[model samples]
Target: MTPSQNFFSDIHSIISQARQNAVRSVNFERVVMYWKIGQRIFEEEQNGEQRAEYGSFLIKTLAEALEPEFGTGFSARQLERFRQFYRTFPIASALRTEFSWTHYKLMLSIDNEDKRAFYEAESIHNLWNARELERQINSQLYERLLLSNDKKAVLAVAKKERLPEKAEHIIKDPMVLEFLGLKQESNYYEQDLESAIISHLQEFLLELGNGFAFVARQKRIHLDGDDFFIDLVFYNRLLQCFVLIEIKTHKLTHQDMGQLQMYVNYYDRVEKADFEKPTIGILLCADKNNTVVKFSLPEDNKQIIASKYELYLPSEKQLLEELEREINKEKD
Candidate 1:
């Protein structure tokens, strides 16, 4: 590229950055304004011992007075949201400027305090927009992580208090792929799934969790006179290792685990650097049997993970069932 072209690119980037900053500043001001309004409303409500009826009447009166002058933004529903926002985040100083009011509004729906904190810390760490935050919440990311780890450990990793010592700390099981736009009933090849993931790579990364960077697709390896192709390949900075994912349209079997183990062995022997950790392999299948997986790998194995993929988001009932199953397995 010419020097003028490079200079123009730099100028364009600067303009974009400035515009983003302007938007952030406006959002921060709006969030603070709502917070203060909530604080005042709470303080007024606290004056009387019968806060239930009094608070309800106060909000209705305020809406009646304010909505007429200031428009629908001051409607009763909005005011209640503001009040709840303050209640949720009691300390004004604890509010994050990086989060928009929409972000907090979404989080306000989450009743679990630990779950809320995990999402808050993750949103700040990953710089998720309101949409991404909503998606993660809807997909039950916290619950999925909880399947393999405790609540405290999940929150600790998200808060960056300590780095993820292993891939399972960040990687989730039963990965959601609703954004891929593939219908659950549709018959598609492995390549189709791979293409869809590439097309929506940003969303895929979000679903894959943090610190992952795309490396290669259908990565080829040669041994002796034969050639082998691995599916999606990613490097996770948090784990400091290569993540090899192989998509299987059918249920996972012991043989499939061996194949992935071989691929992981190849990467660890040839591609892994002296400073990098052992390569991790993930068998992403449509279905998997926990018993088969357990007996297939070594007792101390940590490098290989088997994750099931769904074409769409699982319903609440389905997720609850899965959670119960995981809990039962842990007990055993």
Candidate 2:
């Protein structure tokens, strides 16, 4: 390279390295400061006889003092949160540098320790920002994981650093398709649905869960002079496989499964590299006959899957009933 090019490259490297160090230094300082603040506030609250009243007064007084000087972050509610943060994660050394104080603030709201830890570990591992962390938490990622896998598997997948074995580890069923904005009674063609999903691809990916990168929409595959267009194609880095999704506006049929199987086979035979795992096919339909799905695929089927989607969140009563039915089925 030219002298000028080398000089510029060196300057760029120096700037980049400096910026990274500055960020790390600032984050470490802030985490330490917050831990100390939390400790002080907690200790002051506990020292006096009117501890309960003092806790309330302490946050309010601190907020009053800090907000005018430091700005919007130090509201009474947030002060309380910082105190709770200290209570939840006592050790300053244990604070994750990957996340900011804002991220921890959001996590403190999660009542369940296990659920909070799972989100923390996953967020740090995935390098998620505060907003992404909040979205995943509000999206009920933990609940969806529980529904999809056994508790042991869920814990292992979320807590362990290793990638999960199957696509099911990261894929969520009955994925919330609220972003499509299609009303319950609105009639939409397959193309229309495809367009909606593409337009709202980011939200859809979030609902699809982690590690899915969009490869194509209306992805075409050619074989033996015939052309087939899969509705959606995604690559799951965690599973090390291609995911072929076929969208259906109506109840799933045997034909739908067969067609998805063909697409999966084509990908496995042609598109996939020797090092990549076998392709997975998912049928996203309005409804599915579980019995038919169980029997439709081969007895040893390990890739193809059919799952129903919902336009909006189901009612609490409906979810409870579904839970009860699942429990009863297991009992039988």
Q: In candidate 1, which residue pairs get closer than 3 Å at backbone N, Cα or C atoms, i.e. clash?
A: none
Per-residue alpha-carbon lDDT of candidate 1 for residues 248-323, written as tens digits (9 for 90 to 100): 8889999999999999999999999999999999999999999999999999999999999987877767886898
Give per-residue CA lDDT, model 2, range 1-332, as digits (tens): 45798898999999999999899779877877877888889999998789898889888999999999988777887678778878999987788777787788788888888888889888876778888887677656676666556766766777775578777677776676766888877888878888999999888887776688999888888878999899999998878899999999999999999999999998999899999999999899988887788889998898988877777766545554655565676577
Off by over 4 Å in 2: 1-32, 45-76, 222-225, 313-324
Error of 1 at 267 (Å): 1.0
Candidate 2 at 26: error in angstroms?
6.2
TM-score of 1: 0.96
TM-score of each: 0.96, 0.80
Candidate 1 Cα outliers beyond 4 Å, as residue runs = 1-11
